[model samples]
Target: MTERPADEKDIVLAAQRGEQAAFSELVRRHQRRAYAVARAIVINHEDAEDAVQEAFLHAYRAIDRFLPDQAFGAWLHRIVANAALDVTRRRKVRDADELPETVASPFRDPAEKGELRARLTEALNTLPARQRAVIVLHDVEGYKHAEIGQMLDIPEGTARSDLHYARSQLRQVLGALRQS
Candidate 1:
């Protein structure tokens, strides 16, 4: 008979006791989610990947401090989000000396799917990190405001408001695309 795979709580318990394999299991279970959360905030693939790796390193070191009763995914989510935000902050600092570009799109064909996706990406990149996180978590990932609040350490109302603001911003950007 084959042994059943350990559940998250069991894995956490084992990891807390200095089990390397158990910790690896936790990383395997949550890596995609961690990357998605990081990517949504940082907006650059390499930066997001770096942030997720940093988050996992931090989690591994802090695994002993983890409470078994708490949801590990939620805890990891917070770490990845913070790391991604740090990447964004560092990027902003680096780009501070550059002049902002005000390029209006020159009549791209709306019927082209690639063009639409590119435009959407451009719009998302313009949002503040928190607003981008709110939009991606709530709209793209289908996470509720309460969960987003926990992950981002904000009130649920703030998550909702950020989502509202982000949607409004995207609408304006898309509207400009349509007009152009």
Candidate 2:
């Protein structure tokens, strides 16, 4: 039989058998989305890159135990997201004085677009980490609430509540920005 390109199941099996090449292919397939998810959560490019690297390493180490039926990309995304969250938590605790600043973008019309981006970032920063993660994953990253709940290990109801709360907070922040 001619050797065909391994499907996800084949790759998983090969990875379980300790095939590093198969594992590398898995990483190549999911790396961009994984990094994007990490970047959204961590918000710092360097930190996100580090988190992605750590996540991939963790995934490789843990792949043998991964459920065969689960989508590997989603599984990897969860790992990356968790790693990013850890980075955020550690950074926050390490430097309480180094709170994130909302800087206006220079490329857009300085008067309008800059203010909008700043206000959005401010509102996002105000949310609890879980809520922010849910919002970014669901709204920004285009994951469904169920997928987000699975990735974050939260109940779907909790994810919904977080999304609602995040939306409300952003609205309030935008209103305040308009008033100011």
Candidate 3:
């Protein structure tokens, strides 16, 4: 008889047993969400990609320690968040390569939208790394405070506090931009 398809639990179990193909399957499954998580933190395309790669390698190395009862997506996101923070600290972010025509283009997107995006990005950058992680994980990525705390290895209260402060700071900064 043919074998049944492996479910996520089966995949994790196989991975825990050191099955390389199983781990590869896990990576394939989570890579897009992982990239989104990394991108939200790093705010740069190449750096986010690097973070995802590094996180997967780290996860592969540490997969044996993963508790099967826990949520694998949560566990993986925690690593991805840390990897993005690490990437930011490891080197200065490179400037995007833009052609002069593109840079000088008068046909860019609407001014208000561009300005708002720039302001939001600037505000996010001002936050401390953990605060950024908390806010982005909670707000942008739609993780609960408890899930964020677990991913960040902080108390749930701390995650809530961090998110509050991060949001407050963003509002203050971006609010000022709107008035001026």
Candidate 4:
């Protein structure tokens, strides 16, 4: 008889027992979502990559302490979010001196789309970090407020309020961009 592949809980269990390959499998399975969570916070590609790598390293180190009763992905997502926030905090001083670059979009007129993307990025960056994270986790990633609260360590009501505030801010910013 052939052996079936291990499930997530089994892989996590194996990893907890010091199986490196099992942890690698978990990373491979969840890397995209991890990266997305990191990127949504940090906003820069290289910083997001660094944050994800850092999150994975942190996760690997703590795997032995992981409880299999909770969802592994949720645990990882929270780590990634925290790592991204750390990266954002560290990059603030460095970012002040960096010039912004506009990428031309092939789908729309280069200038218009590039300008729009830049404006949107600016709008997102202006929000308070918690609000930004809440909006990104909820609207962009389609996570529920309860899940966001769990990941962010906030009350569910706080997450909902942050999302409301973030959306309102973005709408005002985007409206100004449209008029100008």
Candidate 5:
């Protein structure tokens, strides 16, 4: 007889008990989505990857505090989002002394890059981290308001408002892109 794979609840229970393999399973299962969340926030692939790694490490250490009844993915994504935002903050501080104009932009590297994506990325960066995260989670990742709220540790109504405001800001900023 073939063995059934352990369910998430069981995995969470085991991980909370200090089982290394169970935590490893959790990491294996959620790392890709975590990377996507981090990537949406950080923009840079290297920074996103680092954020994902740091989030997983923090999750592992904090696993004992996690409740199996709660949604593990949401909890993990929250950590991933925070880590990604930290990277962006650190990067801004590190680059504060230099003008961005002095460096060649990734946007200009490929002539075929979509103008809309570039414009959208810039617009997203202008918003507050929470608002940016809400918009990306809702529109780009297709997460519902409640799920986004849970992942970001905000109220569902706040998530909705954030998304609405973020969309309005992006629309205003990128209005020229639509015209062209």
Candidate 6:
């Protein structure tokens, strides 16, 4: 994507100077991507929103440590992803039956979409959490393997392997769906 307006640098500088309006503008600019990353990990919309909000708070507190050389969006996304994973970890301890939702297209016809989605969701649920996260991040979310590795604290090789395994599993599941 093209760089944010040159004024964004000014906003960042102002935000770093503790200007609330500048910080709010940063939030407004980045919130959608942050929420998408969070929602991809956390599954539940409400929890993802909460995670994004918490991430913004955390990012604000840690803004002093943010490296200006790096893109602000990537940094904020890392925060949101971590917060979302944290939420998932906590929820896992409380809910044994929890499963991540399938990544689905919304533009399809309702009845056919529902059936296909149900099959895909079942397949996704059968994969382990780490594999699911890797697949969703790298495949559905279009994150680079290195970025996914950094977010999940795994090696790039590990992310790649997980994605491979996830694809194999998904293929098997999807094949069964076709057969049925």
Give per-model TM-scores. 0.90, 0.85, 0.81, 0.87, 0.84, 0.79
The alpha-carbon deviation from the true structure for residue 121 of candidate 2, after best TM-score superposition, in angstroms, is 2.0
Winner by lDDT: 1
lDDT of 1 by residue, 80-157 (tens): 998898889998998998876887656767777788778889999889999999999889888999999998899999
Query: lDDT per prediction?
Result: 0.90, 0.83, 0.83, 0.87, 0.84, 0.82
Using TM-score as the yardstick, the better of models 1 and 6 is 1
Q: What lDDT, from 0 to 1, does candidate 6 have?
A: 0.82
Candidate 5 residue-wise lDDT, 1-180, digit = tens: 122247898888878878788888889999889998988778779999999999999999899898889889989999998898898889889989977667645344334558557777878888887788788878889999998877777899999999999999988878855564
Question: Which pairs clash in model 2?
Answer: none
Predicted candidate 6 versus true structure: per-residue lDDT over 69-139, tens digit per residue: 77788788878878988888787797878665786564445367477767777688778767877888887
Where is model 3 more than 4 Å wrong at Cα? 1-6, 92-113
- lDDT score for residue 141 of model 3: 85
Report the lDDT of model 1 for residue 172.
Answer: 97
Give candidate 6 misplaced runs (Cα > 4 Å).
1-7, 97-113, 177-180
**19-103 in candidate 3: lDDT tens per residue?**
7788888998999999988887788789899999999999998999999888899899889988988888774433344334545
For every model in order, what is the number of clashing pairs?
0, 0, 0, 0, 0, 0
Question: Over 4 Å off in model 2, which ranges?
Answer: 1-6, 97-114
- All candidates in order of TM-score, best leading: 1, 4, 2, 5, 3, 6
